[model samples]
Target chain A: TQLLEQSPQFLSIQEGENLTVYCNSSSVFSSLQWYRQEPGEGPVLLVTVVTGGEVKKLKRLTFQFGDARKDSSLHITAAQPGDTGLYLCAGASEAAGNKLTFGGGTRVLVKP
Target chain B: EPEVTQTPSHQVTQMGQEVILRCVPISNHLYFYWYRQILGQKVEFLVSFYNNEISEKSEIFDDQFSVERPDGSNFTLKIRSTKLEDSAMYFCASSRDSGLQAFFGQGTRLTVV
Candidate 1:
């Protein structure tokens, strides 16, 4: 099974702090997606980076895919209480039937 | 701003009972999927459906679990017999095309006792 390992299983930071979450995998993926899920809610897509070394940004959030396509990262600049949530990284492997294999996730708590 | 929608935000059922979780995918989407996240755990993939048939399923998707697109708009996940381990928040998602990012519904929390 393809597995993605996420770093910093738990994080607590004051408002305005910058944070980065990592997702690493041994297997190469055809595409990778990042999602943020709030309590009692389904995850919402943050970004999808398909190309190696690709970078995409949304406001204070930025996502990057590894050059080998075996890893990804999510960086949040100036995190606010609104940014607190469970952040997950998912990969769609070429051999995994386009099915998404998710990482364990990183729970972020941004205190104001 | 179209988004996937799920019904029965929360469900509570006894063990051995059958339960169905419902979702309404985005009107223009053709690919649908189901995933479950136990509290404090990772989200796990259950199944993916397209063209009215299951395209893929994870090991977690045993005979007890099934998915159906009853019509043009609704997608359903049926658990034939609930187990205590089955209690989790089940999410429904859909994509406009394969290999693209999917939009998810709010999720249906299933509690089996």
Candidate 2:
């Protein structure tokens, strides 16, 4: 089974502090997606990385995909209270037939 | 923006009872998926549907679980016999094509007592 494991299941930080969450796996994927979920709601897509060693930035959040497609990371600069949520990483592979394998998620709490 | 929509934000059903979860995917999307997250657990894929048929399913999707696209816009998941373990937040997602960014609905919280 393809498994994506996220480190630091929970994180707490003061506002303006930076935080980084990592997703690692032994199985290679075709693409990796990052999502943030609020309590009682479904996950909202944040970014998707397809190319190896690619990096994308969205304002305060930066996403990086490993060259082997086996890992990814999300780095938040100057995290605000609004950035607090459950961050999840999911991997997609053609062999999986459109199904996404999700990580356990990292719950971040930014205190104001 | 176009997004997936799910009906009945919360559902409460008894064990062994039948429950059907409904979802309407984006009009332009062709692939639909069902995923669930047990409390404090990772989100797990249940099934993926395309072209009016099931493209893939996880082991969690057993005989009691079934998916159908009865119409052009509506996609539904039926649990013939619900169990307490089935209580979780069920999310519906859709994408324009395979391996693309899939948009998700707010989700339906299913509680099986």
Candidate 3:
């Protein structure tokens, strides 16, 4: 079974603090996507990394895919209260028919 | 901006009863998928549909569960017999093609009593 594990299942930080969430897997992926979900809502796509070692930035959020395409990370710089939510990492692999295999989510709480 | 939409934000059904969850994927998308998330658990892929047939499915998608695109626009998932374990947040998603970004619906929360 292909499994993606995320670290720091829960994070609590004050506003203006920075945090990073990591997703790792033993199997290589064709693409990795980051999503943020609010309570009672479906996940909202934040970014997708297709190439190994690729890096993409969205405002204060920075996402990176590992060189082997088996790991990824999300770094939030100077996070604000609005950044508080459940962040999830999902991977798509050709071996898995390109279906997304999701990792356990990281719940972030940024308090003002 | 286009988005996937699901009907009946919440549904409550008794065990052994049947339930149908509906979804309207983004108008232009060609690939449709179903996923579920048990409380406090990771989101898991259930099935993928394309060109009027199932392309892939997980073990969790047993014969008891089925999907259909009855019309060109609406996709539906049917559970022949629901069990207490079937209660979860069911999300519908779609993508323009394979390996692309898949947009998701708000999701239908199914509660099996």
Candidate 4:
């Protein structure tokens, strides 16, 4: 079983502050996706990183896939209250039939 | 934009009773999946369905759990018997393909007593 581990399980930061969430795994994946979920709701996909050493930016949010495709990261610039949510990283491995294995998740609370 | 929709936002049931959760995936999506998240836990994959049958399932999807795409647009998950541990937020998702991003429904919160 491939396991994804996230760092800083819980984070509380003031609005306008920057934060980075990390997702790491020992197994290689074909793709990595970041999702944000609020209470009482399902996760919303934020971004998908496919190629190794690839970086994609979505306005203030930047996502990166590691060179080995075994790790990924999300960096939020000037965080806002609206960004507060549970951030999850899921890895899809072709070896595992392209099934997704999600990380433990990071709870971010942006305080204004 | 199109989205996945789930029915019965919240369900409270007895431990031994059966429960059926429903979902309407995106009109054009071909892949469908069911996932659950116990409170304070990570989301866990249950099963994946396609071509009117199951394509994949996780260890958590045992004999008591089954999935059916009864109609062209509707997908359903049935739990033969509920257990206290079954209480969680059940989410239905769909994607155009296995490598694409999956769109998730709001989810059905199941509370078993």
Query: Best candidate per DockQ, number?
Result: 2
| Tens-digit lDDT track of model 4 for B2-106 | 999999999999999999999999999999999999999889999988888888899999999999988798999999889999999999999898856988999
Clash count for candidate 3 is: 0
Whose lDDT is higher: candidate 2's or candidate 4's? 2
Give the residue spans of candidate 3 off by over 4 A: none
In candidate 4 the C-alpha lDDT for residue A79 amounts to 99
Candidate 1 lDDT, B32-105, residue by residue in tens: 99999998888889999988899899899999999988888899999998999999999999998775798889
Q: Per model, how much of the real contact set is kept?
A: 0.72, 0.78, 0.66, 0.62
Name the better of 2 and 4 by DockQ.
2
Error of 2 at A91 (Å): 0.4
For model 1, the docking class works out as medium
**Docking class for candidate 4:** medium
lDDT of 3 by residue, B1-113 (tens): 99999989999999999999999999999999999999888999999999999999999999999999999999999998899999999999999978679888999999999
TM-score of each: 0.96, 0.98, 0.98, 0.97
For each candidate in turn, give its C-alpha RMSD to the true structure in angstroms: 1.1, 0.8, 0.7, 0.9
Q: Model 3 over residues A69-107: C-alpha lDDT tens digits?
A: 999999999999999899999999989998999999999
Model 2: per-residue Cα lDDT over A23-65, one tens digit each: 9999999999999999999899999999999999999999999
- The Cα RMSD across the true interface for model 1 is 1.1
Which candidate number has the best lDDT?
Answer: 3
Instruction: Quantify all predictions' global Cα lDDT against the true fold.
Output: 0.93, 0.94, 0.95, 0.94
For lDDT, candidate 1 versus 3, the one ahead is 3
